[model samples]
Target: MDPAPSLPPSYEEPAYRVFLDSLDYLPPTDVERIKSAFAFSAKAHAHQKRMSGEPYITHPLAVAGAVVEWRMDADAVCAALLHDTMEDTGATKQELAEKFGKPVAELVDGLSKLDKMEFASYQEAQAENFRKMLMAMARDLRVVLIKLADRQHNVQTMSAMRVDKRVRIARETLEIYAPIALRLGLNKLYRDLQDTSFRLIHPHRAEVLSKALKAARGNRAELLGRIQDGICDKLAHAGLKADVFGREKSLYSIFRKMKDKHLSFSQVLDIYGFRVVVDNVPTCYLALGALHALYKPVPGKFKDYIAIPKANGYQSLHTTLIGPYGTPVEVQIRTREMHNVAQEGVAAHWLYKDDGESSADLQIKTHKWLQSLLEMQSSDSAEFFENVKIDLFPDEVYVFTPKGKILAMPSGATAVDFAYAVHTDVGNHCSAARINHELAPLRTELKNGDLVEIVTSPKATPNPVWLSYVKTGRARSKIRHFLRTTQNEESARLGERLLRQELLSLGVVPISIPGEAWDALVKAGGQQSLEEVYTDIGLGKRLPSVVARRLLAREDIQADKAQHMTLAIHGNEGMAIQLARCCQPIPGDPIIGSIRKGSGMVIHTHDCPSIRKSRSSEPQKWIDVEWEPEDGKLFDLRIRIEVKNTRGVLAQVSGAIAEAGSNIEHVSMDADPERLFTLLRFTIQVANRTHLAAVMRGLRHIPEVTRITRERGGEA
Candidate 1:
C-alpha cells in the first residue's frame, strides 16, 4: 500500500512515462508490478517492429495506456502490457506466470492469437482465435477488456498496412469490435471505434458526410445554443440543478441514419441534441417534465428507459420536442452516476470507487452475458462466432415476465427468444406463449412493456423452424445444439440398425464383434470412437455395406455365404427416416429405402418414378426396406378429384373425408369460372391403403365428383 516513488529523469519514453503517471491511483506495489511487466514485454519484443515502423514495445504500452484510461486494476494493466509476448516472442506462459501472477499470465495467454496451429483457411483460423478469446473472456472479463484495447490500438495505426488488409481490419472492427463495445456499454469506445472504422472503410463517403456535418454545425450553432440555454433555464426555474450540454451525433451514426432511413441529409433532424445530467433519479424525471413544459413534446417519441433499462444496463429518459421554427430537438436525462455508467459501462466498476447498487446491477448483468458465452463454448468455431455476432445487436425491446421482472431483448425478438432468455430449459420445452394474458403462437413478436408468459410442456421440444424467426443468439444456438445432439443420437440408432441388418445378411452375428475389433475398426476409419463411425454411416457419409465389410475384415471372417434380410420401418422414426414427398408411402405400400447423404434413409413407393430413375443410377444406395404392420399410425397421401363447379362442393368434400375417418391436412382447388368442372387436390392422413380407399369411395358418392384418382410422382 506504499505510494509509488517518483520516476527517474533517465526514463524518458513518453508513452511509458504517461502510462506510469496514470497509475497514481494504484498502490506502490501494484505500480511496481506493472512496471516490471512493461520491462519484461519490452525485452521480449525488442527485436520486433510493427507495420508502422515503431518498436513493438510501444504497441503494448499504448494498449496498457488505454486500459489505464478505463481505470482497470493493476493486474489487467500488467496483462495488457504483455498481451502479445506469447504470440510473437518465444516467451512461455510458464515464464510469465513465474514472473507475474497466474491471473496475469492467463490474461496474456487469452489475448495471444493461435498462430502455431494449422487451419484449413484463414477465416477458420480467425474464428478459432475468436472462439478461444471469447471462452477466456467468459472466465475473466479483463481478457476481453485488454483485447479490445489491443484491437483499438492496432486499428488506429493501420495506415501503414496494405489497403486490402486495412479494409479487412476496418470491417472486422465495425462488425465485431464496435458492436462488442456497445454491448459492454462502453459508449465512448464504441463511438471512437465506429467512427474510425467507418472512415477507413468508406473514405469518400465519410469525407462528404464530414463536410456536410461541418456545414450543418455552423448553420445550427445558434439554434442549438438557444435550446441548451432554454433547457438549463427551465430546470433552474423548477429548482433542480443539472448539467446540460449540447450533444452532436457522431459521423458514423449520421451516415447510418441516412442509409438506414433512406433520408436526405436535410431530412435527418435531431442531428444535434441535449443531455441533462442530474443529481438523482427523481430529479431526472422532474427535469424531464420541466424540459417538456419548455417545448412541445413529440407524440410517440419518448422512451422511459429508466423504468426498463436496456440489455446493456443503459438507463435514461429520452424524448423529442418540437423546437422553435418547427425543428425537432432530442433530449436525454439521467443522473450523474448514470452518465458515468453510460459512458464507461462495465468499466465504471473501477471508474467509480463505490460498490453501490448501480455497480452491483451492472456486474450482475455483465456476468449474465458472459455466462451465455460460456454456454455456447461447445459449438463449432464458425457457428460460435456467428452466434456472438448475432448477440451484439444494439437495438432492443423490453418485455416483462409474469412476475413483473423486466427482460430486455433484441428488437424483433419473438417469444422463443424470450423463453430462452428466461432459461434454456424453458426455451427447449416451450410449446406456446401468452402475451399480455392472451394466448399466442410461439413465433409472435414481442413488444415493449408487454407481459409474456411462456407455456412449456415436458413433451415439447425445440422446432427447427424456430431458427428462422428467433432474433437472439442464445435461442438460435440452443435450438441448434439440441437438434444436433438429437440428430446424432437418432443417426447412431439408425446406423446400428443398418449395420446389424447388413451383418445378418453376411451370415455374421452382430453381438460376436469384440471391443478390440470395434476399436480397430474405428482407428482404421480415422474416427475418434465407434459412435462417430456410426454417426457417419447414419448420416450417409459412409455406406452400411462398406462399414460391415470393414468390421468383418478386422475379425478375419469371410462373407461368401449371404442371407437376405429386409430393414423394417415403423413410420415414426425421427429425423433419420423420412418419407419421400414425391410419392408418399403408407404402411401397406411396397417401399424401397434410399440412403441420401446427410439425410439418412428416404422411403419411397416401389413404383415411384423418381425411385425408378434413382435406382437405375444408384442401385447400390437402394436397400430392401418394408413397412411394419400399422399400429394406428397415420401417413400423408395426396389425391386428385375432378368435380362439378358448384357452391358447397368444397364443404361436402371435406365432410365426406371426415366421415370416412380421414383427416385432411391440406387442400387446394383449381377452377376456372367459365368451366363446368373443377380440379381439387387434397393431402389426407390415413392408416393404410385400405383407409385411403375408404376415403376415395366416400368422396365418389358426391354427385359433384366426376373422377377420383391417387396422385404420385408429383403428377395430377
Candidate 2:
C-alpha cells in the first residue's frame, strides 16, 4: 500500500495520507467513508492542540493508520478517526451515526472514556473507566483494537506530558494494555506497548539495558547471520523451501527475563532468534529436522507446539540449538498461517480477512476471554482487578481429563481449580480427585499431562479452605458465592431458632404475620421486613432479644402465650454453626450454644472450661440446647491417652482406636522424660457416645494404656 495521491506533500496531509493508503485493501466506498470521518475529526479538533504542540487531529490519524495496518474492518478505521470527537469536541454520537453509520458510532462510543464523570478517587475513576472500556470491548472487540492504537500513539508521544503523568500512563500501558494485547495474540502490539511503557517508566534502566543489548547485538551480529544462513541452506538442501528471518528480542522482554531470573545482562542468552515460515504443518517439522541437522539441538530445549497449540492458538516448533562458536541460538518453525496468528493474534483473522479455520478458531478463543470479563463484572472492583492481573500471564500447563480430552490451565493450578475449569457443578460437589487414577488431595498441584478425574458426591459441597489454593477466578468466585449463601441460610435458621426459644421463655409466641405487630416491629428495627430482621440476627449483626422486644412491644400482653418451635439439628451444619474447637464437643456430650458475633452459634460441651468462663462474662449470650440423634453423622473428638514409656505403646493405642471403628484424623505426642508415661493427644472422628465408649473400652484393655480421658478446652 502507498500513500494516497489525493493529498499534497504538506506537513498535515502526510498523516492522513498514510491512513488513506493503508485503506487500499478496503473497497472504494469504505475508503471514502474513512476519509470523510478523518475530515470530520480534523474539523472538530481544528482549534485543539496536543501537549506536543502538534494539531490534535494528528493523534487520531496516527491511530487510524495503525488500525489499518492491523487490517481492521472499514468500520474500525472510521471509528479510529472519530473516537475522540464525542469525548473532546461538541459532536454527538447520534450525529456521528447519521454521518457515518450506527456501527461506526457504536465503535466510537465504546472507545470514548468517562472523563466527564465524577468518582471517589483517581484510582476509582481509572478502574471505572477501564471497566467501561472493557465492557465496550467485550461487546465489540474493535473497541480494544482502536484503544490499543490510541495508547500506542500516546505512549510514542508521551515525552510531551509531565513526568508523573508519563509514568502513570506508562504503568497503565504495561500492567493493563500490554497484557491484553498479549492475551489477544497481538504480539506486534504487545511488544511495542511493553517497550514503550518500559522506556517511559524507567528511562535510566531502559537506557542502560538498551546499551547492553546494542553491544550484545553487535558482537553476535555475525553469529546470527551465520545461524540463519546455515538453517536456510540446510532446508534448501533438504528440498524444503521456507522463508527464514531473524527477530531481535524486545528490551522489556529481556529486562523481564533478567529480573524474574535474577540474572545480569551478560547471562541473558538467546538475545535474538530466527523464524522459519513454511506453507503447511508438515513442513514445520521438516524445517525443525533440518535445523537440528545444521546444529546440535540443546537438550530439553525443543518444544513441539504444533501438536498442542497454545491457549492463544499459537502453533510452532521451537528449538534452541548450539550455533557456531557454541552460541545458543533459539529458532522457531511454523507454517505461514501459524506465523500470522502468532504475530497478529486475533487481529490476524481480520488482517487475513478470512472466515476459514484460522480466523474462526482465533475468534472463538478471543470471545471466551471477552466473556470472562462479563463474568468478572459482578465482582467488586478490587477483586475484579486482581483477577484481571491473574489472567494476564501467558504461561500455561496442558492437563488431560480422564477421557483424554486436554485442558489448558495456568501454571500452579490445583486439582480444585481443574474441577471448576471442567464445570462449576463439578467443583461445587467435588469431594476428592484421582490424579492419574491415584487418589489425590483436592489441593494437589496439577502437573502437565496429568490425567485428572474428579470424584464428586451428592452430599459433598465446597469447602472454604479450597479458596486458599485455587488459581482461577471462576473457582474462587464460585466458592465464595457458595460459602456466602450457605452462611446466610445457616445464620438465618439459627437466628430464627434462638428468637423463638427466647420468646417462648418470655411467654410470647411470635407469629410470622401479625399485621400491626409486624409493621411496628419493622419500624422499630429499621428493617424492611421480618426476614431482614431474622437475617440480621443470623449474621450476628443484631440480637434476637432486641428484635423480639420490638415485636412484643407492638402487641398487648397476654398470659399463657408460650410456644416451642422445633429447630432442625443436622450434624456438621456447614459453616452456619460450628462445634467449638476449644471444647471439641460431640453429639453425645451435654452441650450448650453460645451466640458468636458474625459466626452464628458455637456449640460447647457443658463441662468445658471455656464455656464456664464464658458463663461468668457473657451469661446472657448462652442458651440451653439439646442434641437430636441422626444416624451416620461424624463428630470430632479429642482424647488424651497416657501410655507407659514403651516403644510399641503408640502402635497399640492406634490399633485399639481402629478396632473400635474410629478414624484418627490427627495425632500429637508429648514425652515427659521425668515421668514413666507419655501423653498423646489424638483427634478422632466418631458417631456418638456409644462409639467413643467402645474406643475407650478397647484402649483400656491394652495394658500399656494406663489412663485415657476425653480432652475438653485444652485439658482432659
TM per model? 0.95, 0.89
What local distance difference test score does each model get? 0.87, 0.83
User: Which 10-residue span in candidate 2 carries the lowest summed lDDT?
Assistant: 1-10
* Clashing residue pairs, backbone N/CA/C < 3 A, model 2: 185-345
After TM-score superposition, the amount by which residue 414's alpha carbon in candidate 1 deviates from its true location, in angstroms, is 1.3
Clashes of each: 0, 1
Candidate 1 has what TM-score? 0.95
Q: Note each model's CA RMSD in angstroms.
A: 2.6, 4.1
Q: After superposition, how far is residue 28 of candidate 2 from its true place, in Å?
A: 4.0
Best by the lDDT measure = 1
Error of 1 at 439 (Å): 1.8
Which residue pairs in candidate 1 collide?
none
